[model samples]
Target: MLGAMSSIKVQCVIKEKNEIGESPVWEEKDSSLVYVDITGQKVSRWSSLTGQLDSIATENLVGSVVPRKGGGYVIAEGTRFSFVDWVKRSFSTVAHLDKEKPNTRFNDGKVDPAGRFFAGTMGLELRPAVVERKQGSLYSLHPDHSVVHHFDQVDISNGLDWSLDHRVFYYIDSLAYKVEAFDYNIQTGGLSNRRVVYKVEEDDGIPDGMCIDAEGKLWVACYNGGRVLRIDPQTGTQLQKVKLPVQKTTSCCFGGKDYSDLYVTSAYKGMDENALPKEPEAGCIFKVTGLGVKGIPPYSYTG
Candidate 1:
């Protein structure tokens, strides 16, 4: 059973030119916040220490990233997979997005507890931004650089997340109203028994990114919904809603030692600027304290 939403208050902590700050992560070592701008092709590392903002090229339209156990990060580019060493400022191509022909780009993804990185792809077209539906696939990247597609024909494969127990997997198909769940097998990196956990209100928004709390409750950012929803995976129950001052909330992650701080990202580029103040915090980062559940430690890539 999941817990109910508390009437606790949360606030936006940082503001930057996100355009589309897709994935916000907490670097456990330095206690800084690192996130990526998909359109900007910028990877930003924010330090609370000196109140300084550092950024570097992700080399391409980077969708999501995670700190590598060895060093630097594993980045998903425009159909290309690579590694980025922040210290040396170098990029390594581990895999190509299209050894055949570029058709998709990486989106939201994360490291599962069992030490494997899971990510999904989205159909991408530059200039005027033509996004196609069902032109995507879900993949698992092993430490050895071996890639496997668990499924294909994904409609805007947006967010890939796992349960704290590493037994359940939740994913979002942006533009599709449904947020789906699957029986996750950590040992084999396999998913089975897929089901729709929540069919979001189309009028409200499309499901973008998601996170699971310590108690197994699911939290999802409704990209165009103006709020984040708390859900129960087993019963498909809506437990609560955390309202945001933005319409294009991209994603959220739990950081801080206690896992009590919720960091969220938003998008300002997609919406009509004429309606900016309608969401005063459109491109800002938000924080929800005293309301988060601990997440599993990011998988370290030892291979």
Candidate 2:
């Protein structure tokens, strides 16, 4: 079935800008949203019920943050896998990877259905659109505290999601401008049979963060494209497009009580003083509603 094409509304819910706001997850437990700011070095949470926002300062670039079933958050901070105690506002490192490569850091990540934390790394961003290519890899953190290296030679590991039946894994290497799928093993948390599921056009911008909705369609945030695309994974066709006011729409995830609201994150990292004026809402968090679709609940890390 095709996705909705109804007119949607975009509202800026969070006005305080994040240098690079990414990795947004709906924390259903507390009725809040959790996300990270890479260059800003912070993990933040915005309460939907109370209208309060809280942030914890990190020592290095914090890539992603996901709720842990063990009663805290599992985060990829720099190259370390750490546990975050949000209430006390602290985190402790559990493991570290990528020691051989000094410039790489974790980028975007998510939890698989079987509860493994999957995150990938990227080379240092020397400047806008310029990064050390092929210096990164994707890793899986099992519930047992063991890390498995999935693949290497990645320029920018950006987005991730899974199929409805839990048999397919979808991912994005931002620099590749495409989305790939792999045969997923729910029992073993292994992936194989990698192939392209969606090829993004150059005019649509680089595919960043993504999530799957209830209808099995993929919603992809287009960095530098200023839009979110709803795609039919089976046919590799664009079904719907939701435009945003900001040019650097970094990532998006469905939230709200019924998961009908699409929350989008944007970035102003590359915008200079002259360019920033044109896009006044460059770094704000926006909520897109009235799409007439709902998203499934995101999985929390079992580890």
Steric overlap count per candidate: 2, 0
Encode model 2's per-residue lDDT on 77-114: one tens digit a residue. Answer: 78989999977888898778945388988989999999
- Report lDDT (CA) for all predictions: 0.78, 0.90
Check candidate 1 and list the clashing pairs: 79-97, 134-155
**Model 1 poorest 10 in a row by lDDT:** 1-10
Off by over 4 Å in 2: 1-6, 98-100
- lDDT string for model 1 (95-145, tens) is 774542376788888888766777888788443124766788888778888
